[model samples]
Each structure stands twice: as structure tokens, then as C-alpha cells.
Target: KEDYNRNRPHSSLGNITPNEFAMKIAMEKQAA
Candidate 1:
């Protein structure tokens, strides 16, 4: 589960790992 969240790239996330995508969303929310 850790590897999938940190290492695997997701197609729905523009090929970025889930961890990165979540961080991006969190930052966006904070900025808003």
C-alpha cells in the first residue's frame, strides 16, 4: 500500500504518484 501510494503513477492524476496529487490538492485547498 505504501509503494502504491508513493511510487506508482496514476493515469487519472496526469501520471503523477497519488502522494504528489494529494499534496497538490491540499495546497490548492489551503490557498483557496
Candidate 2:
């Protein structure tokens, strides 16, 4: 449900939650 989408870690995303992956990507973009 909503909780899973917001907090579950996904294997495809290097075992990170969706929000974490998004933040990681954002930080990488900023660094670049």
C-alpha cells in the first residue's frame, strides 16, 4: 500500500527505498 511505496527498499534500486534513491540521484545531479 502507500506505506510500502513510501518506505520499502527495492532490489532494483540497490536495496534502497524509492525516496532514498530519488534523493541520491538528486544529490549526484547537483554534484555533477
lDDT of 2 by residue, 1-32 (tens): 99888799999999999999999999999999
lDDT of 1 by residue, 1-32 (tens): 78866879989899999889999999999999
- What overall lDDT goes with each candidate model? 0.90, 0.95
RMSD of each: 1.6, 0.8
> Lowest summed lDDT over 10 consecutive residues: which window, candidate 2?
2-11
| Number of the top-ranking candidate, with lDDT as the measure | 2
Candidate 1: pairs in clash: none
Query: In model 2, what are the clashing residue pairs, if there are any?
Result: none
Residue 10 miss distance in model 2 (angstroms): 0.2
TM-score of each: 0.73, 0.84
- TM-score of candidate 1 against the unseen true structure: 0.73
